[model samples]
Target: MNKRFYIIFTVILVIYFILKYLSGFYIDFEWFRQNNGLSVFWVLFMTKFNVQAMFGTIFIVLFLLNFLMIRILGGKGRFFAENFLDRINIPAIGSSRKLLLLIVTAVVIFTGFVMGGGASAFWKEYLMFKNSVPFTGFPADPVFGRDPGFYVFSLPFYKFLYGWFMSTLVIITIFTVLLHVLNGAIQKTVRGVDLSPFSRAHISIMLAMMVILYGLSYQLAAYELLFSQIGKFYGAGYTAVNANLLAYRAAEVISFIAGALLIFNVFKRSFKLPVIVMLTLIPVYFILGVIYPALQQRFIVVPNELGKETPYIQNNINFTRLAYGIDRVEEIPFANKRELTYADILKNRETLESVRLWDWRPLKQTYKQLQELKQYYYFNDVDVDRYVINGKKIAVNLSARELTIENLGVNSQTWQNQHLIYTHGYGLVMSRVDRITSEGLPVLIIKDIPPV
Candidate 1:
């Protein structure tokens, strides 16, 4: 029985690893395949792998090293050796907690590696920020003095880096404090928990990084005001530009000062200073980050919304047009003449003949009913477009025929039938939009299952 179990487990592990390897290659070829070649795919795959490995190593190494430093070096007494196993009459992990250590280390490694994989998705952002080029011949945004591409190509990676470091530090800080408690570095005194100077210094330095990132968060949020949905329109409005932007700058400065103070406390090795600094951040965030902006929006911007938001509205419009590459569009004036002569009729007859009268909603249903030759062939939509056919520019309604195998009966909808035999639907149904039959049906320009 043991031998059979081992054989089954071994086979499962082999198959699992094989599937993992094959899936990586499949996804690499399918999702990537940039330039339809192997090099780009390999580059992307390795980039992701390298990033994941590097960050994963950082997370695990930092965790393990810190754990060793505090638990092994700084720890005292049998507290560090304590495990939960003995409480329930289970065999206790040895005084060294070797089993507990192994379990904790495994959990931390798994979490870090999984987090690294998720973070790897931001590689494009990193690459873009690294290789960010200035836009040519394009005007900068009126407020930021940055090209439109800065928001698109740069900001995301900065935000991600900030978040990653902040999260890592916070996690490490919590783990360190917990470990400190488990050891005797932080002992429960008569008054409260008494943190040793050594633990205080370590935690303060960790918090200094967090405070700095916290400050930087406001700065990032400043740029993100352009994408804010709190207002009537997207982008910075009166309160945001007038109050919120200024407030973010102030918060950033305050955060930097606060972070520096925390570092100063690390050297002082006094828990009091770091506590005071962190306690202040709550009110600072609420007042400057939240309340100030809300007050400005409610009191000032609300009274004269049109007057306040006009400039911002214009900015949104200009940026939107710029984003879509329609900023240089030319407008022509047209004369609204009511009467027409016979010469006018003859001159514009070709254009008049191409005016569409059929709406696509009913036309799609009509195509599905009449031209859809098979039940599996689905006409998704009727696309109205122009094409020059035989030297005449004509308007036509076209519907691409696609497969819907789910419409097949249960017995007929087999995997082999779906994947191999009837894989895709071919051809499109097309007709001149203006030319309708006597019975009000479309005049077929191109028809049939094989596509005429």
Candidate 2:
């Protein structure tokens, strides 16, 4: 009951925080103004019904994102490590002590990576716990990627066994609690020597391994798997710090500290030099992995789908819908209704070229106008004769024309002037003039053009 209450309370608090931060409400008046403006509070509060509404929206968005990523990636989350030892899968009944240790290691690393690293990381997470608009984005890369805190937390191993169940804090907390119970059970049932004995020399060696492995994983695994696979090859890569490297170093440092504690717990055989080094490094690592990565992953560069990277949404062509242009309008004689005219077509081609075009002319005028206006746009027509942005043909009729918009006749109830910059553009931006607030919700704006 106590744990359940804690869980429920935590969830509510998280939702509240996201609303407070992202929605821009505040107890501190100065912070709110610095972030946006004092007017943001009354405006957002009136717009959204408490923080729960904001959370509901975010949950839906994240779910859609996860679903889309799974479809495109062609695989479920990683289930186990790739080494030969992992192939020997015994069902839940026959799991051994070694397997348990391995699993623990994997869970710790996964948690660390997701959390982030260093004192600041933990502090951010703490603040996130207290306040909630997550200062970060989702951490899991569709491509193979891990964070620094994950590395620090999952010390002494690079095994990928826990899968996606342990990816989030809620899940990780459950796993941690379960592990505590399981560890107690193992200690009682199995009476033997501690297999992992640490010495001054052993500690030195592990440190070396951490450095080597971190370097290799950064240079090879993370760069090759995560960054290169998506960024360079698919033209979706961003130049940034390597995630794998950060994870690896953080994990190694954590393990070193944990190992030191283990040395103290055992009946001391020999004590020569600086044993305290382990304590400093381990806790620092734990702080780094558990607190930092979680905090860091939340540090998002914005999702491409949000129309930051590309302002258009493209989908596979539907063959049945393609009949609009090819089949001419059928005229009705008795009712005196016009036949299925090509000009009245509702598909991508006519939608872009005829109805949606602000100027209703060829691509030349539209392109030239946008260039002069210095406004960015997107098109829904995939086969625009000789124009391209980011190598994909424009799929909608869109323009970046300047419009001196005012709030007097817009959605906002205030009479104010503002430049309506869109976040989701396309034809939607052009047609739904009313829906485009002076602050612009980004018109999913697509444009269509005549067949090239």
Candidate 3:
């Protein structure tokens, strides 16, 4: 009774704290509704809560389905968990199973909620993928021939799905196998490991599912080659395009066929085919997926890297330029033959005449000394710029005289000094780039404070 009372009290306290924490979101929601329109708040509300609930429900449903399947196939009464089931000294067998079920169920719910909550933070990623706008009027990737939009908008969603399914499959398989083993459907014999006919057939189906998932993973890896940093530059270079691409395709095909064969093995008396196929797959994977790619990269591409990688290099240049939104810039190779002449100078006289002579690196310090009237005024930069003044283009040096309040004496940095006394920066300081005073300071056109 005392143990039961403590448990009840702990449950009540946990519920109280959870409610208190959730109450904070209620205040946030009310504020959002008032300040940010109801529609805006609702959109954010639905995106987070709805997405989280949806994916979380999927995890729970999967667990429940696998749990039910195990119960049904393994049969309840025939469980061989003797002597308290893993040393759990419960008084009654039924009570022991119920307690174990409760713990497992709680763990499943907690894990599902956490995983789904994290997944839903990327709601924007899911939304973008659902309504992806293809990038138009751009050169596609040379290897896979996909638009930039595919990688930006779609790859993340596919990867998330892969992870979601793969993790769930792994968990389900382990749980099912363990439960079946506990039910005495699978055991160790003097000869070797033994399996009941029903267990063998049921487990065979799961093996088929895993093989199919592997096929999907292999196919997805093909797209990921574009992001590979296997060469001089990122994206599909020589080895990736020529080697990894072929390997992944072949692996995926083999994976699919192997999955089908595993399913067929269930009908046969003995499971010889699956073991053979699994063993064969490893060496085949190493050859087609590893050794072949390695050989192709070393023997084929390395010997004539420049010639082979030239086309890929050009592809990289185009894609890199596209990434920076400067794809439209025209490229023209420089010719070494022509010598620069005065006529060439005369042709571009406007550009030549407006060139800045002053370097900004030392000019900023000079401005701080010359133009900072009060110690607080600071010239952080000297910028070279052009001005069209009365039918003439003139180049000039400009600097914003920013008020650095921290430079004031510590005691004088009071509220009034910062806000009221030095409320704003004085003004801009300007000068001609080519001109210098007798003291070797810049000749000032827009001088600050008291004139010298």
Per TM-score, the best of the predicted structures is 1
Misplaced by over 4 Å in model 1 are: 1-37, 68-108, 267-276, 330-339, 346-452
Each model's lDDT comes to 0.81, 0.37, 0.78
Better of 2 and 3 by TM-score: 3
Which TM-score value belongs to model 3? 0.64
Encode model 3's per-residue lDDT on 1-452: one tens digit a residue.
44576478769977986898589768877898778677876776678788789888988888778677766865533323442244453443236566668666876887788768877777887888888988887777777778879988999888888887787777767877776665566777696877666666667777788888988987788999888887777777889988999888899999899988888877773557768878988898889888998899889988998887888888887878777878777889887998899999999877776666678988888888777878888888888887775688778898988888888999999999988898778778887786777878887778866432
Q: Best candidate per lDDT, number?
A: 1
Name the candidate, 1 or 3, with the larger TM-score value.
1
TM-score of each: 0.66, 0.21, 0.64
Runs with alpha carbons beyond 4 Å of true place in candidate 2: 1-257, 260-263, 266-279, 282-452
All candidates in order of TM-score, best leading: 1, 3, 2
Span of ten consecutive residues with least summed lDDT in model 1: 82-91
Give lDDT tens digits, candidate 1, residues 281-375: 88998899889989988988889999989989998898789878898789888888778889998999888778887899999998988888887
Clashes per model (N, Cα, C within 3 A): 0, 63, 0
lDDT of 1 at 164: 82
